[model samples]
Target: MQAKEELQTHARSSPAVFGYPRGRDRRGLRFVISVSLQLDSQGCLRRLQSTGHAVGPQGGNTVCAAATALMRSASRALADHSSIVISGHAPREGVLEIEVLQCGAEYHAYLRGVTDVLLRGLKDLALDEPSEVTIRQS
Candidate 1:
């Protein structure tokens, strides 16, 4: 079997930290929590935004610094960038939950952000960075 397939199998069999059980619900598993100092496409100082991340001209240097910092911290934490999972939802006020999968295969880091961040109404958590990285699904 392919390496990706193998990993997927492992994840499914193993209980996920967040979201419904893999066997019970696969379709809802698409959601994720991605955090980077990177600016949203519309671009400004957005601390937390969901998939479809947009970095505009105003994205500025701070964004780079923030994202770089996040990357550095995360890389150090896991020692592997690809396996990192940036979570967006917080179960409480100014608090977040991060669940790094077994063997450090997946790293999820959660942080508190604005309503836009929670407006997406998360149902699951993905370790991978979202393509768009929007707080909510359009």
Candidate 2:
């Protein structure tokens, strides 16, 4: 009974903390994929972190696959640029983290372009799959 009350309190305070919105009963939500983006002072993406899994039926989750692909593609693209110093790794399954340590001024445009595409793709995905994906940009 105490645990149930605690869960109810938590749900009321921050429903999305468990991938369900306030006033909505938790139903039909298999999982949630959270993506976080950190921007630099110049408004360029400096860090990216994605964690969680959107589990679909029959063990096939297209949302998770798509999101992971997009993040990996962006990280690979950034790593290819000589003027950009980036570090990225997948510490475990369904988790990815990338950080841009340094970037030359001349390559700012390129960096912006790549990050813009990544952000746009992620935002679009979130829009299409709101229940399965959540994004937080800082």
Candidate 3:
């Protein structure tokens, strides 16, 4: 009887066990990745930013990985292009920002192609994981 009482007391004091209300625990929360795009007047992508983490299992998160890969690939491609002047950085974990400083008119078509592919990949990922990813454009 005393052991049973002690067990009940322990459970009451332990948040991991019984203290959190149903559906209100931290484990029940969903982490969302937010991707933002800034477009120039000509409808060209001028900037991109991504923040947040899509929490998943112990090994890795497929949604977050896919989003990060797409953004990084786009940034690298733009930076490597001779006609595009770009700056990019990962300010912190799970955050990335890239801005286009200048671009030669001759290479605008190449920029458009890269931007289109990045945007398409991100949109597809968002569609597949509606609860884990979000996209905003400005």
Candidate 4:
């Protein structure tokens, strides 16, 4: 119960999906530090999203669905060699303002899994498209 509450707290306090707030600047540099891994877990990750103030009832559910989709896609592409599990807090202005962490022992496998999906994701993104994906806006 305590863990569940903490999860809810984090979700509630997290920034919106990816939209420029009224007072915040959109063109800002983000802080991120990443390390290479050889035995990482396989999975896809998404930033915690925020739009208005509340994360809403489906916030967690939506994130879970996205994670599952990414993992399934990546896993199928790579067979059973590796898998990915991603988690992060969405930013207020940028698409995803956070350092990506690759968890698990098969770090290398995880890295490849993430990379495979990332390349595909980048291809799917367009420069003109806004990063914001909020409940209200969606």
Candidate 5:
């Protein structure tokens, strides 16, 4: 089956997992940010999209900074893999969309780890803001 078809099937069968959660923390702070990731068969990351603004009295700069760093790091890591096709866009404020197509086998582990780390960091950031991040099999 094709990648798109596989994703559709996976989506239908599996429930979406939380990359981050939408609810209140122990401190009773409610969060509203969310990030969702979809991985294709063979364990390759296919897409990552995030929405919601950074919260805090500090401003949105920190969230933007984190997002920028994550994107840069991911981009650089994938740079050596000519087989992978990556596309990203940050249109409007507090929105990020990144997609990776045709990830080669040799770089699969590295790319997956990179995304995992990025999500972990985003989770940490979500503690203060309303952040939710999730990874799902495609």
Candidate 6:
């Protein structure tokens, strides 16, 4: 299939799903990173979302805090880019969902980098505490 067709196919498929167990608590860090990227289309990033629930025991709270901070950081990265529409919400307990719609051509690299960093952070966290954290990708 052509590149555009392949991108459309990926967009239709289930997003890259990920979840990590929270430390000392079963409620570990969980999130979904999904993006519908297209170059020739009207926009560069058709959809971008990072959403998850982070809440457990005291240790879990720390993990959740880190997760939410990352989310906010990513949000700030795109704050001034007017071509993109961004929305994010987090409860005091640490449930966060950040969505960026219609990402433009200029910030494509920035968004990709942010996504990579987030994934790496989660993977490293899970590795450090195997028993307390679990990571799944599909």
Model 2, 66-110: lDDT tens per residue? 888889998999899899999989877667899999889899988
Q: Give the candidate number with the greatest TM-score.
A: 3
The best-first sequence of candidates by lDDT reads 2, 3, 5, 6, 4, 1
How many clashes show up in model 6?
3
Error of 1 at 132 (Å): 12
Model 3 residue runs over 4 Å out of place are 1-30
Which residue pairs clash in candidate 2? none
- Cα lDDT tens digits, model 1, 38-126, are 33343222343322212221132232234334433533444344544334344432223333332221322322222224322321222
Instruction: Indicate whether candidate 1 or candidate 6 has the larger TM-score.
Output: 6
Error of 6 at 67 (Å): 2.1
Ranking by TM-score: 3, 2, 5, 6, 4, 1
Pairs of colliding residues, candidate 3:
none
What candidate 5 gets wrong by more than 4 Å, as runs, is 1-32, 41-43, 56-64, 128-138
Question: Residue 2, candidate 3: how far off, in angstroms?
Answer: 38
Better of 1 and 5 by lDDT: 5
lDDT of 1: 0.32
TM-score, candidate 3, is 0.75
Q: Evaluated with lDDT, which candidate comes out highest? A: 2
State the local distance difference test value for candidate 3.
Answer: 0.77
lDDT: the better of candidates 3 and 4: 3
* 53 Cα displacement, candidate 6 (Å): 7.0
Tell how far residue 130 is off in model 4, in angstroms.
Answer: 12
Q: What is the C-alpha lDDT of each candidate?
A: 0.32, 0.78, 0.77, 0.36, 0.57, 0.47
For residue 80, what is the lDDT in candidate 5? 60
Candidate 2 residue 98 C-alpha distance from true site, Å: 0.3
TM-scores of the candidates are 0.21, 0.74, 0.75, 0.26, 0.56, 0.50
- In order, how many clashes per candidate? 16, 0, 0, 24, 7, 3
The 10-residue segment of model 1 with minimum total lDDT is 52-61
